[model samples]
Target: MTAEPNFVLDLTLALGTSAMGGYIAHRLKQPALLGYLLTGLIIGPFGFGLQTDVEQIQALAEVGIAFLLFALGVEFSLTELKRVRAIALQGSVLQIGLTTLLVASVSLLSGSAQTPLQGIFLGLVLSLSSTAVVLKTLTERGETSTVHGQVMLGLLIAQDLALGLMLALLPVLNQPDAVGLALGLALLKILGFLAGAIALGRWVVPRLIQHIAATESSELFLLTVVALCLGVAWVTSKLGLSIAMGAFVAGLMISEIDYADQALGKILPLRDTFACLFFASIGMLIDPTLILNNLSTILELVALIMVGKALVILPIVLGFGYSLNTAVKTSFGLNQIGEFSFVLALGGLEMGLITEQRYTLLLGTIAISLMLTPLWIALAPRVVDGLHRLPMLKDILNRAEEPKLLSVPSDLSDHVIVAGYGRVGEVLVNVLLSRGYSVLVVDNSETAVQRLRNRHVPLVPIPFVYGDADNELVLEKTRLETAKALAITLPDPATTRLVLQRALAKAPHLDIIARSHTNEEIDVLTQLGAREVVQPEFEAALELGSHLLNTLGEPPFDIQAVLTRIRDDRYRTIRPVAQVGEA
Candidate 1:
């Protein structure tokens, strides 16, 4: 019998190893991509030599890249992007230009590149940050809606959008004399593709998707979406453009349709499966012996990338007029080289812009930087605290202009102080005003404060403080001594806890009510001296249960008693219990 192909066996090994690696990374509080990379390293040529069909695996990995960018395009939200358009557009462009310039200068000085074009290529490779890792980290930490989180995401979105142009521009860098001609051709091709995509999105996609949905067959819908994604990617490859770029455009076509959410939902499983292979393939390219031989050099490079990138981003955010705390946090969160940089580096390698050894170094550096991103973000608060303690830095970091007061009486007493103006705070403030209660709002978000200012309304003119509620100076401005109660509704648990502690410190007998974002936060906030803690999800459940009982013809008093009992016991009966030896 003829020897059988090893493709199936290789794929199985790759998937199994990646799954176990991902699980371990999750348990250890790291991004699953880190585990996938480690798995690839182990089973690859440099590791145990388990994978025999590396070429086939890499070909499938290309599909993963296509699907990954496709999903991103489908999930793209114009509304959210609009919220931070200034930073997302102008800020990201500035950041990319500055980072590339700095890296090129350094590469030339160190004699790492033979020519200016090669140096520029090297700079481009390192300029992008990993969106997958940073976003997953932000979601895990419950900071997605925080100011720094929003800013990081906005910058990341812009970077990802810029990748398509970067891919097109890389080829032009390979040509020296025909640079302008090559660039013009690239732009023309991109414009032609975009026009075709827009035309499809505007007319064809909606009708096509609607008809597909009318079939009411899940399998058929999924197959259609997959075909569309692959077909566009194939076309782009034929046009001498990146397949990933075509896939993204295909996704944008789907995004404009009413079935965008359903399409995304159907394609997610396939995207994730293929995306795993892509990350694994990247890992397979890393050589362990090379890394071991140059361990110190790799570590040094990782540090330089993280610190240098952070320093570059810090002032850019500060220049945009965000607070020092926000700027610092955003910088820390995005200091590492991103996953998309691998795509650019691979393109460079293929175009002969960089050598094999240099490609290996870039891969290793990117991996290490991504692995450290989560830990770096976790340390940001502590870094901010240290900065705040330094006498020279304190004033500068804390210098926020006070918000203009609106129609405030000199004798403002026996009123409530609301520490946040988010969804919960907004409603609470409206209710308090409706009930003729004097209210003072304290918020850190410049956008939120600006919105509050623009509400020229039927409601009473509100007084507000434009600074972090956790800061003592901000609390002092809230007239804590004369306030009837304090409501802590900040989305960040750490900030909420700090606000509660600081408010109580200023007025020992203040009746402070705090909001809990997680189950564990309830006990922590109570222990920190909150008079009452409210878990929004739990409260919603209680309301639903009470309504169900009343609908069954039960007495109102009886329903009230049941809810009261649960609340009186601090939700001990309904809260989730920890399993044995659970972390």
Candidate 2:
């Protein structure tokens, strides 16, 4: 008897292997996508050849890309982008243009491209960095809200926005005479699509989502959201643009609606599931033998791409007035070729702009680069610290706009030094100022420092230092020896730890209050000499629990006692710890 096709079995194998891989990656403290990719490499045709339905898996992977971009659109924040608009908008443009010019020039000089158009196509392909990988890595490191993180994300957003134009302009690159017309037409198409999307978001989508919510059937709500996402993607594909771009546009439309959070919550599971297939499919394309044979060449290309891209990006960020630390991290985070480069490479191959061999080489280089991104980012802090330690590099790296200070006493002693000017720092400063405490703020963000300068505190002038508090020089400027206390409220844990260590090294007897993002961090910070470590979430939970007990007629004295015990123990009772052999 003939057997029917087993797409379900194929799906099961793919997802099962992906989950195992992801779990292993998590245990190793690496990005889970690396695990998914390795899984694909093992089971793909070029490896053990366990899966027969590779094409079907790839088709599903397209949905993964759509959902990935869709979720990005939903989470996209205009306010965050606005904060780094100068670098995000202008720096991205400069980066793309410079990278393309440099790559094309090198290709021509090396005789790698037979024609200028081919060289330019190669440049465009290499210019884009992987937004998916970088964003995932940043989120994992808990650096999404930091200055460098915001800058990297802002530049990435600009790149994604430019992707629509790249998709349109790539097809006509061979026809040099028609390049201008193609660009103009592409711009018009993008503008038209955006205008229509804005109109719909402002009028149609909200009403439709509201109506869907009224039904109170979650399945219906999800289906409608998916339909809108894919429907828009389909339209963009028909318009000779990418479905990914269309999906992002659709997400942006939903983001403006009141139900954005609800839509995001409902779609996250599907996005994650499909996104696994997408990353795995990329792994499936790796021909292990090809890489083994061309190992030396691929390694050379990988180093060239990463280092060259970093060189191109570093100055762009610094020239935009960002700190060296910010620039270095941003450069490291975005030096790799993006996944979308694969799409562009395929288009170039179809148009005969590059050979099949060149296409394969580019694919291998991109995959390796993407795999290295997380590890590279993890090492960036060390690189920055090393640079700072060098005598010659120290001055240039720390060179930034002079600190803008407000009214300050000549003898700024017995004052509190706040290490961050973010949400936590702002509140702490206000409280200290209102209570007539002298305050000095240290922050790296120019925008945050400007906000401090613009503060109308009546008679209380907000004196501040505009630099990374983690740096010894910046911390020294805070007058740690004479400060009453140090409040470490930096969002990045590494930076927070560094600031705490440096502060104590300068003033061993200073009362220090530190903020911790995780339970594990509370223990680490406390052990590092922080007099008190506060986990905001745990504090919020304790407050809520106390209210609940009060409403239940429990004595306030007893509630306080219970809270004091938990606090005194550094939250050991509530902190979750992995048991032996848990993994």
Candidate 3:
């Protein structure tokens, strides 16, 4: 008897290829999502043709998209969502509206969009900026706490919230004859879903999670979570909306529960696996011959998508009262078309609102834009600096005023400047104050400053400067030139290097001691002119060794001598030696 093949082998092959591609992309210092896409391209029907069941692969890919949105909803905390509500909601709406109006006009005039529906769909797709790419890049650079980073995050969150609404309205837009009625009906359905979701979230979902969590079986809990996500998604699909919307709502319901973190931890791996497949499926849709024949069009579209969006967003950010540097960085970070655009594009194609050729072009252009996102983010700081040097833009750049978030004594001098109010910073602040030295804290977190103000510590009043330590304006307020030493407690190497470099430039003789997390960072920080670079892990090891020696009745003098030797040798003496194993 002959045996029939199953889809399991197909699934394994897809994941294996994606893993290999992701590894290669990592080695090349690129985003892994790009690798996944390339992998799909290679194995897809249009390429090497390894996978025969394209329909099955695509069906899984849809589930992947749902999980991706679900993960996004879970990570977005209500506190964070509420904090950026004004700018996120209003700024995003304005940005989307303006970008859509302009893009639609351009499409109509160019004859690319034969009907208003196609133009509107085009506008909507282009209006969304990639949240995953921007967030990943910012987190890697450790800029998530910076003003520009916060603004970008807020805007991305707003875009995510608006995604469901956009998905619902897209189908209605396809119906030109009953556009108004369809739109109204869609809105009502969405509203009903929201109301029902809120009620479930408040009354039922939390208790359901509690019961599932009480089982204490990780496997069962995971199964239940998946079921919830899919169940809500199925409900939305029945109501003529996207499964992604339902998944997002399911996530929101769980987010307020105590088990949210555990749920996130359990689901993240699955979400990532599926998300990789989703990107791969997108790559599979690309026809290389089509791209080869329309290379110029692809290049032109990429330019419009990346450059046009950036130019549009820059003014929007600036108008929101952010500085030019912040505005520039935020704009560049969000310039690329988003992952959700793929969903919308797929919807448009299914409805015949766009041709397959146009869909391929969008995929190609979006890929190019996403690939360029990291480079654009890297250039933002330098671009801001260059613009400040130009006589024309200098005035605008200099117009940024210092925020009145903190008060520092005007006569402060010979104090220590602590650049961060995290655990280390707080410790440094207390020690400095106890030793009768005036300390100034430079932290970007407003919440940290508020906590400091409310603290009931016995030490004398500590002056705080609330802003990014890397900003020269903030550094100047710290009286860096007069300060005896600068203690950088910030854990981010990028921020640490920037602050160290800027402080040296401001005052050549300023003594700076910075924290580092890696040997490479230690070297980098030291080269950047930090007087002392302390790696926490090494220090902890040293403390442990000292305690063990004391317990063993080793002479205190001997212990001190060994510790002094290690410190004097810059930890070279205590650094672990590499061992060779017998073959």
Candidate 4:
């Protein structure tokens, strides 16, 4: 007997293929998103014809978008949202307005749109930048806590909110007379939903999390968090909003609570899985024939999106009083068209505002733009640096404002510079302070800086410098040249290396103690000019050996001598030696 087609088999094949594609992309040092999209392009009906059940895969892909939005919401904190609120709100509005006008004008001039409605729709589609790509790159580069990073995140948050409004308006754009009334009603409904969610978040959600936590059941806690995410998503759909909108609201609700991190941890796996599918499904929609035929059009639109958006955004960021370095970086980071553009394209297709061919063009442009984001970000800093070297541009580039240089006593000198304020740094600070040594603490975490500021310790002089130690400006602000010693305790190996190089360049004579995770890292850090490198593993091993020796009634003097010898040999005696031929 012949078997019927099975959707389960197709689903497994799609996911499995996406995994291989993602792995390949990772190996190439490219974003897994590119691989996921390529997977869809290959296995989709247009290529190998593996995923014949496209509709089912697309349905599951919707879940991926919801989870992506939900995770974004969880990461969105009120403090960060508020920090750049003015710039985020105003800059988003300005960027959207300017981009729409520019693109709509171009669309009209180029005959891309048959009607004003279509032109407006097309313009809005190009206005947004991809939050997923920008955030992922920023986090990977460890720039999420930097000045430009904050600005980029703030603008993305603003754009996400703007996207919801655009989605609300798209359905009614075809109705000229009913447009205002429909928008008003929609806004009212959204505001009402938000108010209710805020009330619930302020009371019910936190209590629910508390009760769930009290159960001491991690499974129950995770289950409840998922329920809350889906429940809100359903409620939003019922209220005539997108599921993505609901998921974002759900995230905002959980973000304000003590369990925000826990909720994020629980939802991340599902979010990532679904997000991969979402990106891959986007890939599935690409028509290879259409792209080959419209290569010129695709290239033209990609140039417009990559170049036009950056030109528009650079001035907006500059006008916000940000340094040119930050402005250029922010603009470059946002040069790509976003995933939300696909949503708008779909809505436009549903409303008959755009043809299938145009939709194909939009998808191709967005995919190409996203593919270029990482490269653009990598080159942005160097580009800005080059521009600053030009005689005329140098003055203009440096003219923009820098982070407020905090005040320290003029006589502050001979202090120890602590490069991180995490657990290890904190302990070191306490020990240094108790000995009457002045400590200059530098950290990139805003929360840590704020906490240190608010801490009420009368007569204690802990000068906290709020910036990334990796930045030369931030390092210079610490007056490392005058410091007696430097401690590098940052968790990231690359960042530690960067800070070490920068610090040693400025103060070659500074006594530097560094932390390493492995024997290789210990050697590498010492070679980088660290006066002493402490590997946690060998230290733990020594402690354990000392304890064992004491239990065996070995002499205390002998134990001290053994530990001292191990330290003198740089943990050589305790570490297993590699075979001479081993790599």
Candidate 5:
């Protein structure tokens, strides 16, 4: 029998170590993933050997990939992906081509006995990086909607596709005939898988999820979703495809289903908890001792691959008539190898297509490149700015307005100010905007900022000067002096009172409206200088209580629409508090 006590001990230690690492990384303002990777490095066989059950952990890690890809596929539809086909496909292809050429040239110069096929495999490995790493970094920084974020996500999608193909065709290419047949067969196989999944998910899965959700137990919902992910994984593997490929296919099939969304929501609570284990486990596979002994060669390959790959990607994007900003941003994003690299390296090792040494080098190099991406992106603005200053290249970037010091009066009569673009603020902004009053918004959510920017809303473009509304800086941005009225739509009563106090001191004559969820809170804010205190629940109850007196069949209080209306405001805060500043 398996050692149950050992299993329990291992899990407890893994969870504790991983949690500590995540907390530490969260405090450091870096991706929690890096902390998990570091944790694995410390606890792996090389360090504490706490994860003694390597086989079991590997199996779980494999399951995590299947589930993760399934979720990605569910979210990434073909239609949405097609919009950025230019950036994703061409960029990924270029990244691969130039990276391979550079790596092969370096290998040959270094006197490695690697042949053409080995060179191609090595090139493939060098071209890929840590998907989990780069994506987490992008996500943590709140850059997903930026032009660079979209391009980065698209290329990652393409990388996933390329990885699927490599997983399919690489092993089969051991023979020349198999090489010719592999592409067609793999394509046909993928098509069949896609067709079958679409039919099953649309027709059959919704009924199953509704039945599960009807029970209203969150645990059952989560369990059923995991089963679906793993069941699809097992089914796909039986068809001679990778489990991840199956997971992705299953994800795409369920993209349009209502049950899919519900089931997925339940499946993804603390997803990265297990997913971090997946990344950290991969890092554990790397024996840093071997990496240390060959530090010179590793550093040389790292520089060669990064610089050479960037050179290859630069001209291609520039040739596409992307402004220097777009071109440079595109290059910086692709400069790092990512998730696909790990997939390709491990697959190559499994197929015996690459030697163990090459595999280690490839993994270590990709890891380093991924770790460097955040710094690269952080420094990109200055680099692009410097490049933009050149006349020949200057005309390429999209024009953005140069910000000027907006001098408005410190206090005003009958003016408007919105705080926190939440549900109530959304409706208030729309109603106020329809009246054509000059509306000033203060919020810290980056997502909200991008959304408002996309709509070209007539509001001050800067993020909230301070994270907390209680701060003097944020109140200053709202120009307490220039406003005739200020509406505090944020949920927190303490914050509303704090803003009211600041407003009274700064713009004593301004009318203040504070939104509160409870009557007691509203009473407190009114005492603090708020001219009016509106409770959303009470407002809804009043409206419904009125409509109930007349329409007879009006739908019960629509909490969702009320919430949506609140979001429709100019500051309808797209910038969530979770994803704070610039990515």
Candidate 6:
């Protein structure tokens, strides 16, 4: 092996381009992957080609996909799938098949460079927007448990499995025998690979990780975890399967481990960097000029991608016993192009199943489709409402709807507000509700609020207003005058301050419990009139400590519950300091 270079230019370009993409994407409410794709587009063969070190950079970028999907596999579980089986399988299959038929037909008619079979591949790809991107967006916004989000995750998982299968099929699609043989071999390899990985995870990796954790070298721990994933992936690839399968299996194997969350947290930042690179690489594949010249194709493709797919999916979801509106929204969510399309296209090219022109067309189409998902999702309600009123869709809408009668009891007293509804604050809500305390939920979540509203659950069921909790008006609407106290259950300190300030002014006597994202937030929230502070990772750490102590045969056996009790901590008395300035 050669010695490592003092400075890697390609690495520099990857980092630089990724940073640029990330910053820009952050500003645009888009995924960094989009930026990465743009980076690749800017510096790709068409753009700068800047070939001083293209090969090494491309290789580095590819690892982003592996690491990203590996982590993604951990996020998904068969258990979760079973829990959401109704949406995951039914919604996904409906979305994929419908999107495929519509997109393929339109592509063939629109004179796309791709063949009909390639169009099918393109549609399948289009149906799979990046789960990594969407999930991160949802998580950051604290909407994972939201109905549409859950539906989105279910559909994404289906797409992921499809992408994996596409990987198996793409490299052998032209050869019928190879297709059957390779796919069969791939399936068997994946199954065995998963079994082997689980065995290692259940019996070997945990002990190894425990030993490594004891060493307390984070660098070492991260390296070891990375090694495990890469090692397993390599073994699978060597066994005649795609490395992508190995990556996903690696994540699944460790998903159930005791330190799985910790392991994931440590690797997450690094995973994001490479993931951005992966998206940039995808962007590099697009030809902006070609896209500009192909406006008609793009328009037709986008319409087919969204309209035809939605038409097919809405009916299927309705058939499966969901209401038309819910089905329509669900269909809208799946109407984007995914990262899988790029992978599939590459696979086709490698297998001589597709031409370069067709691959480019697919890439551009997928990119355009993906670019539209957030916008589309944002506009779903209006579109669904309009569609419901349509003469054609109205009957379908009436046939089976998700359920209506938002009995929003208008008679609720103002109460303290908590933004996030995660586990940490669920207990708080329970305590408040059980004690006959009327608390107004200031959550922006569409589904959670909808659930609480549907049940007419506490305080005569006031509507749970939907929007960013950090906004001043969201707090204002919560009726701080009637509010007895306020709680900022969100982890972000800056956001906490926005809520805390409004609370102090509106109801000075209000007892506020604010969540902290950092240690500094403890001091900051104290200054901001937060009567108490909660940190997500801090809570998790306490749990881990208790878990560790019990595992080591400590005297007390009730470690977990004991850790959950915050009575010992001066959480109530922790007066928030000024939102800014020094201690």
Q: Which candidate is the best by lDDT?
A: 2
Question: What is the lDDT, from 0 to 100, of the residue 492 in candidate 2?
Answer: 91
lDDT ranking from best candidate downward:
2, 1, 4, 3, 5, 6
Per-model TM-score, in order, reads: 0.83, 0.92, 0.82, 0.81, 0.66, 0.66
Task: Score candidate 3 by TM-score against the native.
Answer: 0.82
- Report the C-alpha lDDT of model 2 over 1-583, residue by residue, as the tens digit: 6544677777888999999999999889778989999998888888898878899998888888788778777877555556899998899999999999999999999998988888888998999998777876776687888999989978887787687788888877767788898888877887787788888888999899999999999999999999999998888777666777788788888886789999999888998998888888888888889899899999999999899999999999989877777888999999999988888899889989999999989989998998899988988888988987799977765555334443346789999999898889999998998898989989887778778777867845688887888877777778889999999999898889988988899899999999998667887899899999998988999999999999999999999999999999887766666621131
Question: Cα miss at 270, model 3 (Å)?
Answer: 3.0
lDDT of 1 by residue, 268-378 (tens): 888778877877887887778888888898999999889999999999998887767788899999999987787788988999988998888888898788778888998
The residue-level lDDT of candidate 1 at 326 comes to 80
Judging by TM-score, tell me the better candidate of 2 and 3: 2
How accurate locally is residue 329 in candidate 2, as Cα lDDT from 0 to 100? 90
Tell how far residue 522 is off in model 1, in angstroms: 2.9
lDDT of each: 0.81, 0.85, 0.80, 0.80, 0.65, 0.65
Give the top-scoring candidate (TM-score): 2
Per-residue lDDT of model 4, residues 356-411, tens digit only:
87888888888788878888987886786578568986665444332354545678
For candidate 3, lDDT tens digit of each residue in 443-477? 86655788678764465457888776777777888
**Candidate 2: C-alpha RMSD after superposition:** 3.0
lDDT tens readout by residue for model 5, 291-313? 79888888887787677766777
**Could you give me the TM-score of model 2 versus the true structure?**
0.92
Flag regions of model 3 displaced more than 4 Å: 1-6, 62-75, 115-117, 136-147, 174-215, 225-261, 349-352, 389-396, 401-406, 421-437, 444-462, 489-493, 515-519, 532-583
Summarize candidate 6's per-residue lDDT along 1-583 as a digit string, tens digits: 7634622666677678778877898678665555666777787666777535555665766576568767766765555445567767776776677677776787688765357776776666666666655665555544455445666677776666555566677666666778888777767866776677768868987788889999989889999989877887678657755556577677877777677788788778877877776666666666788888886877776776667666776677667554444465567766666665666667667765568766666667777776666556656656755765689866654443322322223555655566665455566777777777776665543445555666544335644555445444445566667666777775333445766775687678888877776555666777767677776666676667777888898767477456546424523223245322323
